[model samples]
Structures are given as structure tokens and as C-alpha cells.
Target: MFKRVTVLLGLNADAVADHAKASATVVKILRTLTTTVQGLAELRNQLGLGHGRAAPSPALTRHARLALNSTVTVTEFVIDTWQDRIDRGKLPPCSQ
Candidate 1:
């Protein structure tokens, strides 16, 4: 789904992330965030309690904490970038 984010924004996913990291276009690189979001999806699908798994989750408490923190990081980056675009008059005018 995070990969789709770049697409929705009319960007090539891998290219934009690579460029962001290499060019320092923004304050920080976002390539690893793709991996983090993907990993979280896999972990939740395979071992999450909601999946009705028979075995106990191999994910430790620390791992879950890290996932939450990573999610927050991604969320903040997205919001900040979105606001930056609005500030720069890059995004289309809001209907409202």
C-alpha cells in the first residue's frame, strides 16, 4: 500500500525513493520506510493474534514497539511532505 503512495502522487516508487536518498531533496531518506511498512504487513499476516494462529507469535514486545514507532515515523514524513507541497503551491487547490 505504501508503494501505491508514490503512484498516487504520480511518481515512480523506487526512483523517487532513490532520488530522495541520493539528492537530499527532502530532510531525510524514505527508502527504508517502504521496507518497514512491507515487513509490518508480513509480520501481521503471519503471526498476529488477529490471524487466529495456533502458535504463539514469535514477535517480541520490542519488535511490536519498533513497528509502532516506525509507523509513526512514516506517518510524520508523509504529513510533513504533504504540508510542504501545499506551502510551495505544488498541490492542486482543495475544493473545500
Candidate 2:
């Protein structure tokens, strides 16, 4: 998903060696967003939500809810930035 986002932003995912690259700004934002998503994935795994566990799980606490909200916010920002670039003709429209 991160790779796809980078590509959509006209960045070379493979060429991103560091945050100082030409596409660093957008890449860094995407990387941070990716990390947030990864954390959520890890939390899910820890809660046994990734596998079929017979044991019942506890309810989501405040921290979990905050994490979910943060992830959504970052995702929306990335999508909005991409769309803004497209709208400004800075990026090509996605191919059908």
C-alpha cells in the first residue's frame, strides 16, 4: 500500500534511500503514515485479531481508539495531498 501510494505520487519507491532524496517530503510523510499503519497491524496481531483465537479479546481501550483515529487522519492527509497535486496538474491522472 505504501509503495502504491509513493508510485501514485510520482516517486520511485526503490530509489528512496533516505529522507534527503528529491521526493523526501512526500516520501517522509508516506513513510510516517506507513509506520502508523504498521503499528496498528502489530497491535492487531498482539490482540490475536490476525489469527483465529478461541479466547475472547478485550475491548479497545482509549489508546487503541486514538491510534485508529490517528491512522485515519494520516491516511486522509496523504490522499488529499495526492488529489491536490492531481488537481493542480502536478501529477498525471491515474490510468484506467
Worst ten-residue run, lDDT, model 2? 10-19
- Cα misplacement distance, residue 55 of candidate 1 (Å): 7.0
lDDT of 1: 0.68
lDDT of 2 by residue, 15-69 (tens): 3445466566756766777778777777778774548777866646886687779
For residues 1-96, could you state the per-residue lDDT of candidate 1 as single tens digits?
A: 787764554333333554656545332345567777888888788768775678888988998898889889888877766666677676765577
TM-scores for all candidates?
0.66, 0.59
Query: Over 4 Å off in model 2, which ranges?
Result: 10-30, 92-96
In angstroms, give how far residue 5 of model 2 lies from its true place: 1.0
Each prediction's number of clashing residue pairs: 0, 0
Deviation of model 2 at 38, angstroms: 1.7
Tell me model 2's lDDT, rounded to 2 decimals.
0.69
Record all residue pairs in model 1 with backbone atoms less than 3 Å apart, i.e. clashing.
none
